[model samples]
Target chain A: MRRTAPITILALTCTLLISMACAVALGPASISPGSLVTLPNAWMIIWDVRLPRVIAAALVGCALAVAGTAMQGLFRNSMADPYIIGTSSGGALGATLSIVLFAGTGRPVFAFAGAAIATFAVYIIARQGGKIPVETLLLSGVALSMLLSAFLSFLMYTAGRSLHQIMFWLMGGFWNVSWDDVIVAILIPVGCLIIYLYARDINIISLGEEDAIHLGVNVERLKQILLFVSAFLTGIAVSIAGAIGFIGLITPHVMRLIVGPDHRVLFPAAALAGGILLLWSDTLTRTFANDMPVGIITACFGAPFFIYLLRSRMKA
Target chain B: MKPVEVIGIDVSYGAKKVLEAISLHVERGEILGIIGPNGAGKTTLVKAMSRIVSPENGTVYLNDQNLDSFSFREMAQQVAVVPQGISISFDYTVRDIVMMGRHPYIERLSSGTSRDLEICDRAMQLANVTHLAGSSVNAISGGERQRALIARALAQEPKILLLDEATSNLDISHRIEILNIIRSLTGKITVISVFHDLNLAAYYCDRLIMLKDRRVYAVGPPEDILTTETIRAVFGIDTFIRHHPFTMRPYVLPVYESPAALGSARRVHVVCGGGTGSDLLYALHREGFQVSAGVLNIFDTDYATAAALKIPCVTEAPFAAISPGARKDLGRCIDATSAVVVTAMPIGQGNIENLRILEDFQDKPVILLGDGGNPSFQDCTGGEADAIVRGLLDRGAVTAERIEEVLRVLHGAA
Candidate 1:
């Protein structure tokens, strides 16, 4: 197990790097691999347009994947994804509200604030004697998701002609992602690293709270730290990417099947896998259907694969 | 000095009080067993000692320090708890589970040290789970899973260990295996185990604290705490208490349920002695018959069984000839009962009077489990008791080969 861990990590890092380079080469106004060494236009296009978009996609993917893994570990439920905790739904609601009320100028900022507030609400609702019991957290997350989604539906109902814009944003993409977006999305890897530092404690918590407490884990504190960091990561990712789904939910599961459930190894692997998956999905969305949102491509491809994996795992 | 002392602690789950003002001290390096019927607060007490559930009223002291003063890490280093009935759905291997015990000591970035691995290896070896180190915890049997969890607790190397019904899921052999491991740790680690099985608790625990209705009913060595009267009062069931022949510990056998509905059944007087009538007495009592036995010597096994079953029995002094007063008392009992059963008890000189009482009941229906054996072999009075049995058979008393047939004849007639 020890020998396999380092090797698995190295392999994932390599996969992420290779996939990024390949993704940069595949978009519209395609430049040949050999000409890219000399051509100034290709360099200009890669640096000014493609590089920032790819960076944002990678950040969003890594953030969602790491957040999903942490949430799954926090709740000790296999089905606990980033969206299960109301972060994405809250982000979508904030983005739609901003688009309707403020004309979409500060949509990312409002979305980030909404994600943070939603997580804080869930955390406060679930807290009892400083401990956030998993069942209570899960229920609160579900309830908050339901409440926020109802509000979002009301906004969509009022959005008549502009409903197309709201719906397209909801489908999620990185069409106009900029250097400013990349700067804000940098917190994804930073938040993931913080959560990774507590991977051992998270592993113990996954055994159950009482078990973690007896094993000397400050279970309440660990829950607070991991949930806050993951929520922050999800907030930044959702603010920029406009609620990309499945990357966070599916990446951790794929990594877990390959590397086992030890969060120490699974966290980083999920981040790398998430980055590679989103980078390629973004490249395909841009190359094949220029107007299509990356979120549609992800759900179009990721959901069927997730069901296949689930059915196969059940058979095993 | 005692290492753990819980002083007047009360605990509640929401509005329902689970434990109230419970005070107990666990001596250092002793296996203290907690026993009680369901809802008796046994698990609550263990949780209190481990500091899992904070007390509403009082304090728990670990060594000389207040338990509340210790940080989570310090408390974990001193105390470890094996919780009951935890289901691990994740596919963590046995070694992965046990290695979690080192979480308190390991640094944030460090995976684990050689010392941690050594401790895990020793704990698994002590728990007899070294061979299962690679197996997923959920894939193992209940007994093996229990040992793996115990191994995890042992890896923590706590000075005090608390188990909450840790062996309830195990069968007898596995239960013994786990208890034997715990027994060997008696002098090194203080153990407070909640046991569902009274017999196992009596056999393994150095001292027992029996709980009744959220309070300590009795606290002492098993011999004193496991008395039949205590069992009846606390558990509300009639039980037979006897010293285990090897360990000399109190062993309890439940005899019958409450006789609320059984009191209305027909009374059957039994004539037997020397342990032969014990099964018949228990079966009849459990089958809802109001049973009475006769003239058994005070020290006879049959007498103990009858007393345990709470059957009304006429008795005689041990090794003494049945006196005329006792015979008259036996006669009164025989006259009152509707039927009588004579079990295959050997009649010695001292108890031959029981056979003579059978002659008085000749007019009443009597079922004999003679099994065609000569009564002279059992007769100590040189064919005197044999002649009484033969005469009874000739007088059209029913002859049955087994106790079941006797019950059939009597219950059928009823």
Candidate 2:
């Protein structure tokens, strides 16, 4: 109950809206606000090309952040995120399988199934008795991620013609997004809302599973619901964009410092900040870097920040 | 109906059994304490009652209903548990932690109401943590954090509260303060707590269930359960149980004795009275000496110590001088022993015979225990007792200052 939580959430929300407008307007073929009105080609560029891409990027970012925040709370480890826990890798492999076998017909469904299975696998592997120790959970996630990546790599190797599409998807960008993808991304808000309803339970559970139980949280069921929802969100993000990495890892952590870890405030704040972050990252790559994969820029910044977190946590 | 009843519950972790066929019941508003040595399954029993661990073979009943029939929220509304301690991963404020106690009542769609906040504030006040409401749980001290947890448990407004050694980690003042708060909750909230400190359990609990080797060893009021014999049998230590001066509750004082040293089977008679010889008697007995003390009146403090240690004593009646029968018994005790040790006790008319009898055993090695200075024999019999001591000293009676030195001299003489 920090006094500044509402203010922080409101401020991040406004910032995210502004960032989304700038991202939609400032693409490679920059359409000015005046041109959007008079020029039909400019209007088509804005409507068909840039608008859906920017909207999907923002929604995917929100999904990843909400999933990450829930994960950090569920594991009671600040370092946990959808990407770190093999959810994204599982989604990547699932998408790659659909691309190789069915020509990407029902990719989101396959991705979601894969993500859910991987998350539950990691959970079962890490659990000892009734508790999941943080170290075991992290190590199990790493092991599962490696195995999923291997499957993804094998799928890419056998597909000669669709290899380029798989490679581009794996690198993660919104260059080919459309209105249909935007329609699918609408599910992100529904997932976020469902998770938001359990924000208080997440706050109690982060204290520890046993304390959560004492406080009337159904700890095992809560863990299952959170993991399923996080996998759902991660699966959708991967299906729309690609296996984007650190928006899930870094945004929730930084927002926690500002909004002070009440998941009610933290979930919204992290979601908004994550949307702003990925919107700007996508904007930067498409505008200046000749539409390179946005995941490269994010990882370049995310890996170093992750190392800093590790070092600081070690000192603590 | 009892507020809580367990019907021969057995709990196990994997293949290891923690509690075996443990059955108990709690009255409506009494504080029932569970106490035992480590690994005696005290905490596991609490866990079973709280539904943190389901019993493998038996059922727990709350308000005459099977425990498993209630949902997690319903069970929490009925029973609140205060664990020993917890490390919060997030920086939740004390108020935030306490407000979580109202979760079972609050619907998922709505936040805590003004009434919930009122209960939180009242709970904080009762736990003496009102001033710390806004502080982060991580920033507070351990004792303060423990109190905040108590505040959280209080805010639950539960019908039955289970505490697993909740005050065991705090200091004496904090322990008493928190227990006092819980004690004030009696007649409204039924409490079942696990206690490591037997004295606190005795002082705070209305009744106690003592566990030994995973079974219910004894259950009664503290005065009846915390006896010298029961404590000796359960804890395997000698305890001097007495009523507290103010509360009249049983107070346990452990008679700290090291293991008996090997190869010393010699007998030493301690000539002590007026509580001077208690420590010496304990030390000698711990050192494997077949020690005996007396010609002591039945009411002497040393006589009590001797009795507690199970040392053979030649006792006289209270406030009585040494009788002929006691004197003859004392002579027999000294003759059977290898050495005599005279502690610094007052030489009154009633006990001067304790020193006079020392003369007959002159050839036996005699050791005088002094107060690290001169052996001040408080001779109320004037020069007569002093002359007898002087005669013993003239006949090579050695004087030692402390118990260690007395033990050394006795061992050397042996």
Q: Compare the candidates by lDDT and give the number of the best one.
A: 2
Residue-level lDDT tens digits of model 2 in A265-306: 999998998898999999999999999999899989988988
For each candidate, give its TM-score against the true structure. Answer: 0.91, 0.98
Candidate 1 collision pairs: none
CA lDDT of each candidate? Answer: 0.84, 0.90
RMSD of each: 3.3, 1.5
Q: DockQ, per-model, please?
A: 0.72, 0.85
Tell me the lDDT of candidate 1: 0.84
Query: Model 1: per-residue lDDT, tens digit, A164-281?
Result: 7677657789887889889888767778889999999988988888888899998778877887787778878877877787787788887888888889889988999899899888
Stretches off by above 4 angstroms in model 1 are: A33-40, A96-109, A120-143, A153-168, A305-316, B260-268, B283-292, B310-340, B348-353, B356-365, B372-385, B404-414
Residue lDDT tens for model 1, B13-32: 98999998898998899999
What is the clash count for each candidate, in the order shown? 0, 0
Task: Give fnat for candidate 1.
Answer: 0.72
True contacts kept of each: 0.72, 0.81
